[model samples]
Target: MAWDYKVIDGSEEKTDLGFRDEPALNHKRTRILDACKRRDIDDLQALAISRGGFLTDAIRCQAWPILLGVHVDQRGEQDGISDSWTTLKKHRDEGQVKLDVNRSFVYYPNDDTQAQLDEKKSQLSDLITEVLRRQPYLCYFQGYHDICQVFLLVLPPATRAAAVARLSALRIRDFMLPSLNPSVAQLRLIPDILRAADPTLYAHVSRTEPFFALPDTLTMFAHNVRRYSDIARLFDALLAREQAFTLYVFAQIVLRRRDELFLQDEPDMLHFTLSKLPQDLDLDALIVNTAALFERFPPESLRSWRSVSSSSTLKTVRDVSACAAQTLEDGHRFFEKHHRELIWAQRRDKVLRTAWANRALILAVVVGAGAVYFRKAPIWSNLAWSVPDHYF
Candidate 1:
């Protein structure tokens, strides 16, 4: 059941360096199709990361579900379940989903009617709602609809929920937390990558934090990249690699603009420049260079890697080869584990904050579930001050 997907009208702009000839384009398409036929995920990933992305949205319709481990049989699984989901408890984030869905399709489908777009928005709303219903614990972020809209455009309706659920769990789960701290933690990786790739440029841009990458990276560039085909092609690589590769791609973008970045001596100017992507983006070069950069400076070698906790989905899940075998069940399992960890982190932070805020009160007494007991020991005094100021 496909809607009026009026976006991809075959007027895809050609990249100067990527797939310049029909034979090359055909070769890439053939490889992707062949990989899909054989269910050779590794080859599919290689093709995705290679020259041109699953060349067209047509090809993406065939290849994307496979990339996310959404099997052919899994299509339409969400169809009959919606009624039941409606009866069950609704997710807390549904209101925000409606708000975001209402504002979607802002950039593409230039010729569709308000009626057609409203239908698309309705479908988008249902798709997001269905996923959230299935996994009520998954927090919703403002830009999540941007990412979901891409899948809705590329995949058939039956498979849309399955594809997006895996994507939400495996790929962008970090952003779906109640707090944006995990997402900010991902932004922290960008500078580490930049520093490793080019010390001079990193030093030049070091005065500013990595919040510049927050918008683009959070939405997987779906929010910032206005062109439909360009973003769809970008997703080809993004879906194929580990989540950390997204950070590397942005880092490569930063590295590519070294001269432009160096010109901005002031941190504010450099940050403002960096926050917006270039008008003339050569996605092919960026993807290729990003791949090379990741190869050279993999995540484990970076400083941020050490800081990511053991339970982070950032660390535990999202390995390309590992994800190739993962199913929706695996995704849910990983998500539940990660969600628990995130909740624990939040609670720990809250307790630390409260303890620090009322240090004098906590210092005066030892309150236990069993009883409230006064403490007058050196150990209590030491413990009271031990709560670090950084946690505050």
Candidate 2:
């Protein structure tokens, strides 16, 4: 529901950065700022990779082109044509904060020469000023919106500085990094944890007559469900529902093992192992498989085949060797399943009520207009009721 990083500061050796170190920190921040001034995302990225602190990842990401490749390939789609152009206008009119990249990005084509690039970079220095000032909020800043553009959209000119300082100092990015997704890393542990939680069901599922791991999950539980249209939106809708309930249980497991997962364990290597080559592993199998660690009836829920269906009532508990049990669905309210409809219904009701309230006001406005134009109106039009009954 909310980002956790804004609260959790990175692990650091020293708590205090007193007067003597302030100048050096400023010098380092300044050197990167200066290089950014020179239209050198290249140098800026190098400085980021070389440094290791809270801001390191942000610096590396912003300057990734320099770290990964020289050409700075256009890998992602630019937002939209009109949208892209309008952004520059908004920045000029609203952002007020200067960036080192604006004019260069706007006037010169992206395929421009070196000198034009440098000029644009000078204009865009406001970007650094903006981020350095807002220090705490940067990491949770959504992608697709340029941090500069978002600043203009959300904050007034005065508040912009403090917002960017909050952004640059945010630890949100650590949890959001490609490798560090906690859900994926903890998924594999689901099966083992489930085995520990309920050994009999684990044994039944493992060595019994009717046992099957989720068929589609090849590498650590990635789903390969049949895609019916442009996307597997239907499956995702189901996954979302089940996942809501799953997170409630998984949080319990993860919280109990917080020391092992987030603290004591080797974070870097753990990230690589859990993550796949192209994309990371999934959490579903672990959750579902852990669900399977309970004694299941016919074991059909884990299978994607709707053609061969069965119902399951087995619910696993926290303790080991506990018998599979059924928790009644009576009075159970699963929010994720019906949330969209609930939201739509609420909105529709609100709109209807608002419209009903507005109608009397609309009628009064009409009566006022009629009174204002009373002189111009034909007497017959106003006196229609006087003659209408006799005519009828």
| Model 2 stretches astray by more than 4 angstroms | 1-20, 50-392
lDDT of 1 by residue, 1-392 (tens): 11112234333344332545667766777888998888777887788877667777777877887777676554446322445556668888898899999999999766677888898999999899988998777889988999999888887777898788888876777787677777888888888887888888888888998899988899999988887777887999998888888888899888889888888988889889999988577887789888999999998889888877554556755466677566656656766776677788789999999999999877666555214332456677688789899888
lDDT (Cα) of model 1: 0.79
Give the per-residue lDDT of model 2 (tens digit) for 271-314.
Answer: 33222222221333333443344334222233222221111101
lDDT of 2 at 334: 17
Window of ten residues with lowest summed lDDT in model 2:
323-332
Predictions in order: lDDT: 0.79, 0.31
**Cα RMSD, each candidate:** 8.5, 24.6
Each candidate structure's TM-score, on Cα atoms with residue i matched to residue i, is: 0.83, 0.18
Top candidate by lDDT = 1
